[model samples]
Target: MIDVRAVNYTLQVAGRPLHILKNVSLQTKPSEVVAIVGPSGSGKTSLLMLLAGLERVTSGSLAVNGADLTALGEDDLARFRRHTMGIVFQSFHLIPSLSAIDNVGLALEIAAPELSQSQVREQASAALAAVGLAERLEHRPTALSGGEQQRVGLARAMVANPPLLLADEPTGNLDQKTGAMVIELMFNLARERGTAVVLITHDAALAARADRVLTMTQGELVEAAVTH
Candidate 1:
């Protein structure tokens, strides 16, 4: 679950404050899929970053899974992200040197340090298999196609089964067909795990598939409509 209220984000640009987001409020419950659709520079990704605790808001309250993200210290924020959230990036942020299995296992290792190596591998393997990538577990990012790489990224995000998933343009880099496959997998997996999803995308049809659709303009959350 996520709760954000009147959040504002600002940046220093040439010694002046640059406002990136304004008066943003959002709420999501378990197993709910919320899609944010907006033009470039409308602060959709900025909102996602705020939800992930990657960026501190300038003002207002933000909470995920009942943890006050605005109140957490840097170390606590990092821990919260590891334990409570999963993120899928548009760029498929994978470690090139590590195999797919290792990349996925690393998430579990970080979140649950008590897990043994074999346990990590077993869970990681199961995650990749869930994404239909059991055969590519040993391959590095460079060895996989764009779609395959994104699937690996998905496995990495979902391996720990966090309660909330933040995905920014998850299918932006793939072909239409591959993107559809990845999106379907993402929705199905989230539903199966009862994970709340906050998706940032530009695709209207894709946004329409969510339980709710939100539109942002000029750093403001201007519209919210239930789509399903």
Candidate 2:
């Protein structure tokens, strides 16, 4: 679950303060998918970064799965990210040298350090299979197609079964057909696993598929009509 209250993010550009997010607030329950649709520079990605603890919130609070993200120290944020949240970026972010399985298992190996190598392998393999990438487990990112690489990224994000998933324009880099496939796979798998998802996307159709939709404009967030 996620609870963000009146969050504001400000940045220093040159000499004046630039407000990136203003009074943004939203809540999500287990297994729910919340999509954020916004124009460029509307603060959607910044909100996701804040949720992932990659950026600090200048005002208000962010609580994800019962952890007060604003109050967490640097080391604590890293540990929390490893164990409690999963993030999928616009870029796949897979290592060039690591195989798909290793890329997926790396997070698990860190979050569940007590698990044996075999156990980690087993979990990662299951996650890859769930994302329809079982046969590509041994392939590196460069060897796979765009969709396959994104599937590997999804597997990596889901392998640890974190409580919440944050995705920022996950399909932005792929073709329309490939992007649709990735979106469907992500939503179906997250729903099946009972994981809450916060998706940042510009595609209206994709945003419509979520349980709730929020629109961002000029750094403010407002509830958009749910189409379906």
Candidate 3:
């Protein structure tokens, strides 16, 4: 679950403060899929970064899965993210040398230090299979296609079974059909595992698939009514 209230992010530019997020507030429940749609420079990614603990909020409160992100120190935030948050970035952040299974298994190994290497590998393999990548487990990112690479990314994110998933333009690099497939896989997996998702995307149709859609303009966020 996520609870964000009056969050603001400002950066120093040219000796003046530039506000990237303005009084943004939102909440998500477990297994809830929330989509954020916005134009370029609308601060959608900034909001995601704040939630993921990659960036600090200038003001306001953000709580994810009972952790007060706004109040935590850097070390605590990193630990929280490792144990509680799964992140999918537009650019697949896979290590070039590691195979898909290892990349995913690495996440599990990091998140659950108590797990043995064999246990991590088994869980990572399961995650890859869940995303339709059973046959490609041993393949490296360079050997995989854009969609396949993204699937590996997805598997890595979910391998830990974190309480919340944050995706930023997850399908941005893939073709339409591939993107759709990836999106479906992501939602299906999230639903099956009761993982709350906060998706940041530019595609309206993709946003429409979420349980709730929030539009951002000039750093402000407002929920949009779904039109059936």
RMSD of 3: 0.9
Q: What is the lDDT of candidate 2?
A: 0.92
* Candidate 2 global TM-score: 0.98
Candidate 3 regions off by >4 Å? none
**Candidate 2, run of 10 with poorest lDDT:** 219-228
The CA root-mean-square deviation of candidate 2, after full C-alpha superposition on the true structure, stands at: 0.8
lDDT of 2 at 125: 96
Q: What is the lDDT of residue 127 in candidate 2?
A: 94
Clashes of each: 0, 0, 0
- 1-228, model 2: which lDDT tens digit per residue? 889999999999999999999998988888899999989999998999999999999999999898999999999999999998888889999999999999998978988999999999999999999988889889999999988988898888888998888999999999988999999999998889898999998899888889999999999999997678
lDDT of 2 at 108: 82
User: Which whole-number lDDT from 0 to 100 does residue 168 have in model 3?
Assistant: 96
What tens digits encode model 3's per-residue C-alpha lDDT throughout 9-114?
Answer: 9999999999999999998888899999989999999999899989998999999898898788989988999999899989999999999999999999989999
lDDT for 84 (candidate 2): 85
Q: Least accurate stretch of 10 residues (summed lDDT) in model 3?
A: 219-228
